[model samples]
Target chain A: MKRSERLVDMTKYLMERPHTLISLPFFAQRYGAAKSSISEDLAILKHTLAGNQDGILETVAGAAGGVRYIPYLGKEHAENYLEDLAVRVQDPKRILPGNFVYLSDILGNPQDLRQIGKLIATRYAYAKVDTVMTIETKGIALAQAVARYLNVPFVTARKRSKVTEGATVSVNYISSSLDRVSKMELPTRALPKGSNVLIVDDFMKGGGTLTGMQELVHEFEGSITGICVLCEADFDKEKLVSDYLSLIKIDQINQQEKVISSKPGNFLTETDFSRF
Target chain B: MKRSERLVDMTKYLMERPHTLISLPFFAQRYGAAKSSISEDLAILKHTLAGNQDGILETVAGAAGGVRYIPYLGKEHAENYLEDLAVRVQDPKRILPGNFVYLSDILGNPQDLRQIGKLIATRYAYAKVDTVMTIETKGIALAQAVARYLNVPFVTARKRSKVTEGATVSVNYISSSLDRVSKMELPTRALPKGSNVLIVDDFMKGGGTLTGMQELVHEFEGSITGICVLCEADFDKEKLVSDYLSLIKIDQINQQEKVISSKPGNFLTETDFSRF
Candidate 1:
């Protein structure tokens, strides 16, 4: 193939398999091009991605060395997207009963998920995340999006057990929203033992749900690499977990006044973007 | 930017926003190049995608003209993936009590989701799908995958009502597995009226869950563009719905013998890949 054609295919291939190492010889064989020429094509891809500031193509130097595409959005891109997302979150129409902000629209949106996923994946890009875990219903989208970019499998925890999942390990946590204890469980075989898990959810009210996931990870004999939520209710009474990151923070939701206020969460500051 | 850089960025840009059009002038301005140069870049990208048969770069002509990256996998790719998937499905270890097959591993896999999403997207690439819908829990991953490729929003139908989702429109369907009448619903504001929706799910036994989603779509005054499931049990007594596509067919599940059999479904024969 020609250099132009090789560059286009290479970009698509790498983008699809983020955080995956591709050997130079593999590319060379795929394109039927010389190793030196393959190197030149990769250089163009790496330089193009770096110039756009939306992706990174890291080159590993050794016998096993190859290019790995890291879905790292630049700091500026992160700030702009989060700010816009926060503004969208401030819409008064999103206010639900009992101070719950409706985020189904954002969670269901592909464009939003892409950015949110990339942003979260960028934060944990360097972390040893063997699996992405989320509680089912809403958090599945966010978890899948992040998993797509990180090139890792994502498992969903369910509030109720189903016949399809065989056996499960359950965990109980305080349901702050309902003021009761709620149980969530994961399939026993869904996650491997001693795996590093990144917990994610759509919303956090007092961080109860997050703790449930943390405990479930422990039940599987796995470690929690990090925890992140798409939205956090900042005004909610004392949180159950503190070492977590959120993309958007909902500071206020006035029921009677029909008003809402939000801002970008700690994900902007807590994430280390210096590697790019 | 040079032609090489433009091709790389253009490929990534179009791949990210599938089914969306980008005018020549937009690319021209973004790359600081002439319209003719941008046209040439798109041609190279188009030819490359066409050659691979895994994607389609559709070009529109005249005043409102641009390119659309359609995530269409070729017939061979579809056949190969589904065959390998069927083999994996035949694993006796995947059999659960009540003759249910364990697919949590495949559903959680990013690679499998990517292939499944592209295959379904390929089938519905030319359809007018306003949104993708699925029943909650397992189907969310499949819905999200297809929605990402189609660049549309996906809404989940819940088995039980939740406070997070505002008001919901509920429907009753026969749960063949439990042999009981079950209810499922979607939030009132989740899907807009008069949408052309594509329904997807992870598994189908007697097609009960799919029909429930179909009814929910109708309740929202939306039209069903297409219905698809990742796996369908052929041994089931009868199906509730007839007009649907499945990627894999589970022929038998012998609980006593601990044996399972599967094969590719109707997707390969039903889809039209002649456009390429």
Candidate 2:
């Protein structure tokens, strides 16, 4: 293959398996190129990603050295995307009954999912997340997107038990939005003990569902490294959890006036874009 | 940017948005290159993908001239993956009390989802599918994966409606497995009338859920393009739907003996790999 063809194929291969180590010799053998030639090809791929601030290619040195692609969006890119996303969220037609914002359309969208995934992947580029976790229905898409970018498995917490999943581990937490106790479960066979988990959700009104997920993660002998939500209903009366990050913060949703107020969340300022 | 850098960026850009057309002028502006230069970049990409039999780059000429990336996997790739998947599914440990095989691990896997998506996309690459549909819970991931490759919106049929989704279209069908009438619904805004929908699911015992989803699609004045399942249980005495494809077929699951028999299904034979 020519250098140009190799470069295109190499980029796709690395992007599909982020945070994975690929030895130089393996690439040489796969492409039938010399080791030195493979190294030069990678140099171009890494330099291009770094130049755009969308990704990082770490070239490990030593007897066990290789290249690892880290999905890290530059600070400027993250800010730009969040700003655009926030503006999109400000549409008045998205408002729903009881102060709930209708976001199913965006969540079901593949393009939006890609952008959201790349942004979330930026935050956890170095967190060493073993798995991405989310509770069922609304949160599954977010989890899947992040997992794809992070190149890890994502487990979904279920509200009801299903025969297809076999044995399960159950947990209960207060749903602050409804002021009632809610239960969620994970397939006992899904996550192994002592795994590092990143919890994500589509919407966080009072952080109730997120807390339930946190408890479930802990019960499995896993650690909750971080928590993030696509949208946080700031107008909600009370919050059940803190120390969380949101991509877009909904400060107000005026149903009578058909208006909404939102902006980029603390994610932009909190993330360490300097990893490059 | 040099040709090498351009190829790397183009691959990433096109991979991120599969099956969506990007005008030549858009790429030219993004890369600060001329239209002729952009055409060369796409030529290299299309040629590389064709040689690998991993993707298709459809070009539209004339005033709306552009390129679109179609995620495609050849027949050999499908057979190899499904055969390997079948061997893994034969593990007796996956059998549960009611003869249900545990497959949450595969469903939640990113690598598995990517391959499954490519294989299904190859079958329907020319089907003119406007949307991919699946019933909620376990099937969402499969639907999203296929939709991502096809560059279409995925709509989930919910067993119960939520206030956040606004209005919905509901349908009733006989749950063959449970032998009872069951209801399913799709949000009114999820799909457009006169659209072509490709239905997908994670598992199929009697395909009762699929029938319900098909009915809901019809209620919206849409047509069912095709039906696909990740796994189909042949042990079921009767099936409610036909003309469906399965990635793997579970021939048997004996709970008493803790045995499972599975193999690649008719998907491989039914699909036409000659498109490449």
Q: For every candidate structure, what is the RMSD over all alpha carbons to the true structure, in angstroms?
A: 0.9, 1.4
lDDT per residue (tens digit) for residues A154-221 in model 1:
99999886767888899899888888999999989899999999999999988888999999999988
Instruction: Write down the TM-score of every candidate.
Output: 0.99, 0.97
Residue B63 miss distance in model 2 (angstroms): 3.0
Relative to the true structure, candidate 1 reaches a TM of 0.99
Deviation of model 2 at A169, angstroms: 1.3
Residue A263 miss distance in model 1 (angstroms): 0.2
Q: Positional deviation of A274 in candidate 2, in angstroms?
A: 1.7
DockQ, all models: 0.87, 0.77
**lDDT per model vs. reference:** 0.92, 0.89
Which 10-residue window of candidate 2 chain B scores lowest in summed lDDT? B159-168
The CAPRI class of candidate 1 is high
Write down the DockQ of candidate 1: 0.87
Judged by whole-model lDDT over C-alpha atoms, candidate 1 comes out at: 0.92
- TM-score of B chain for each model? 0.99, 0.96
Candidate 1 segments whose C-alpha is farther than 4 A from its true place:
none
lDDT tens digits, residues B1-276, model 1? 999999999999999999999898899999999999888888898888989898999999988998888999988899999999999999999999988899988988899999999999999999999999988888899999999999999998888877777888999998887889999988898899999999999889988888888888889899999999999999978899999999999999998999999999998899998767
